[model samples]
Target chain A: AQRVTQPEKLLSVFKGAPVELKCNYSYSGSPELFWYVQYSRQRLQLLLRHISRESIKGFTADLNKGETSFHLKKPFAQEEDSAMYYCALDIQGAQKLVFGQGTRLTINP
Target chain B: EAGVTQSPTHLIKTRGQQATLRCSPISGHTSVYWYQQALGLGLQFLLWYDEGEERNRGNFPPRFSGRQFPNYSSELNVNALELEDSALYLCASSLAKRVRGQPQHFGDGTRLSIL
Candidate 1:
């Protein structure tokens, strides 16, 4: 079975500090990874996908097949970036996605 | 273009009762997906419908069922609801089956409370 693991339940960082939300997956085939974010009082929205290879809002994630990890990172965290981040993995042959427990990131002023 | 829309922002029901949640995908979108976000379970896939057909379903029991209409709107019906069934049900939509890289746009979700 395909599974996604997000080790951190909450991460707090000061503004301008670097942020990294860990994510790991267990799948046999080529996996499609995505990072979704939900801000306060807002609906969940897609932040970026591994397939795109383009950064969105200063966030970027690289697919590491060897380590089975797709960690989301940003060089400088902003107060507005505080939100809940979810890592998802789309397994082979399954059109649906398996999501991690999500990490609530709080950027302190 | 408008994003995905779901009906009844909040729903309250008692045990053994039935709860029906509705979702209308964005204009021209043919795929709709249902997910349950419980307190601790995160988001779990419940159902997927496209072109008025049930394409996939999660590990949820048969009590959790849904259907898509000709206009690409969908409804999720939960039978014999239990207290554990209380959660935020989210609805998302995409272009179609062939749009591999398209992200799923989501709605504000319906917060269901089972008494």
Candidate 2:
């Protein structure tokens, strides 16, 4: 079974502090990884994908095949950065995404 | 360019009633996807439609069905709606050829309330 696991449901970080959201996946073959974000009253939007290997809005994630992890990180958290983040995996031939439960990031003002 | 659009921002239906949600993909996108997000729950894939055909579906039951039109628009019909069906139904669209790698653009979603 292809599954995505997000260890934390909610993460609170002080403004200017570094933040990290953990995600782990289980898949037999090579998988495609993506991070999606949803802000308050905003629609869900793509943040970044492993294939692109780029950062978005100061946040970045590295796909670690050995550890089977794709953790999202930011050097400094900001109040506007608070949102719900989801880790998704595209399994081979599935043609659909398997999303993690999501982590609600809270940046303290 | 305009993004995906979903009709009826909110709908309320009682048990055993039916609910229908509509979606219009982006201008050049031919793949539409449906997902359900219950309160305090994550998104669950519902169905996928591409090129006016049913491409794949999640673990949902037959009661939850949908179809894609020739124009690439889609509709989801929930029959015998249950209380658990109360959730936000989200619609996403992507390019048909590079679907897996293409980021899906989303609509604000239709909020369904089953009472």
Candidate 3:
């Protein structure tokens, strides 16, 4: 069975602190991972994908096949960065997304 | 261009009743997907439709079914709704060109509350 896991349900950090939102997955085939963010009163939107390897909003996630992880990280946390973040896995050729439970990050000023 | 759209921003129904949710894909997009976002459960894939065909479905019961029209718009019908069936149903669309890792555009979603 394919599954995505975000171990932290809630994470808090002071402004300017480093932030890391962990995500792990279980799949038998090569995986395509993505990070999605949903801010208050806003629709869910794509944050970044591992394949793109580009940073979005100063956040970067590296897909580590050996560890089965794609943890999202940022050098400095900002108040605006607070939101519900979900880690998703795209089943190749299936056009489906398996999502994790999501982690709500709170940046306290 | 307009993005994907979903109807009836909110819907309310009682147990054992049926609920119908609608979605319209972005122009030129032939693939439509449905997902359920329940509290604490996160998002779960429900169904996928492309070009008037049911491409694939997630691990859900037959009571949770849907279809795509020739216009690429779709409707999801939930029969015998239960209390646990309450959720925010989301619709997404993408080009059906078999492109590897194509990103999907999402709608605001319909919040269905089962009474």
Candidate 4:
């Protein structure tokens, strides 16, 4: 079975502090990972994908095959960064996406 | 270009009734997907339609069925609605069949409530 897991249900950090939202997956084959964010009163949207290796809104996630993890990280947390983040996995040949329970990040000023 | 669009931002239905949800893929998109986001549970894939064919489906029961139109628009019908069926139904679109790294554009979603 393929599964995505975000260990932290809620992560709180003070403004300017570093933030990390851990994500892990279980798959037999190579996995494509993605980070999606949903802000208050807004639609859920893609934040970044591991293949792109691009940072969006000061956030970056590295896919570590050895650890089976793709944790999202930011050097300095901002108030606007607070949102519900979900980690997803797309296996080869499957058009469907498997998503994690999601983690809510709160940046307190 | 317009993003994926879904109808009836919110819906209310009685238990044992049936409910239908609609979605229109973005211009030129050939694939449409449906997902359910319950209160506690995470987003779960419901169905996938491409080129007017059902490519794949989640673990949901046959009561949850849908079809795609020639225009690339789609409709999801849930039979025998139960209270547990209340959720946010999200629709997404992709240019082609989902490859390894293709990102899906999403709609705001329809909030369905079962009484």
Q: Residue-wise lDDT of candidate 1 within A1-109, one digit each (tens)? A: 6899999999999999999999999987778989999999999999998999999999999999999899999999999999999999875544687899999999999
Pick the lDDT winner. Answer: 4
Runs in model 1 with CA error above 4 Å?
none
Task: Give lDDT tens digits, candidate 3, residues A60-108.
Answer: 9999999999999999999999999999999987899999999999999
Q: TM-score each candidate.
A: 0.98, 0.97, 0.97, 0.98
True contacts kept of 1: 0.61
- Clash pairs, candidate 3, are none
Model 2, stretches more than 4 Å misplaced?
A: none
Per-prediction DockQ, in order? 0.70, 0.73, 0.70, 0.87
Candidate 1 residue lDDT tens string, B46-87: 988989999899989999999999999999999999999999
Tens digits of lDDT, candidate 2, B22-79: 9999998998999999987789989989998888899899999999999999999999
Give i-RMS (Å) per prediction: 1.4, 1.3, 1.2, 0.8
Highest DockQ against the true fold, candidate: 4
Per-model TM-score of chain B: 0.97, 0.96, 0.97, 0.98
Score chain A of each prediction against the true chain A by TM-score and list the results. Answer: 0.97, 0.98, 0.99, 0.98
Evaluated against the true structure, the overall lDDT of model 4 is 0.94
Using TM-score, give the best candidate's number: 4
Fnat: each model in turn? 0.61, 0.68, 0.61, 0.88
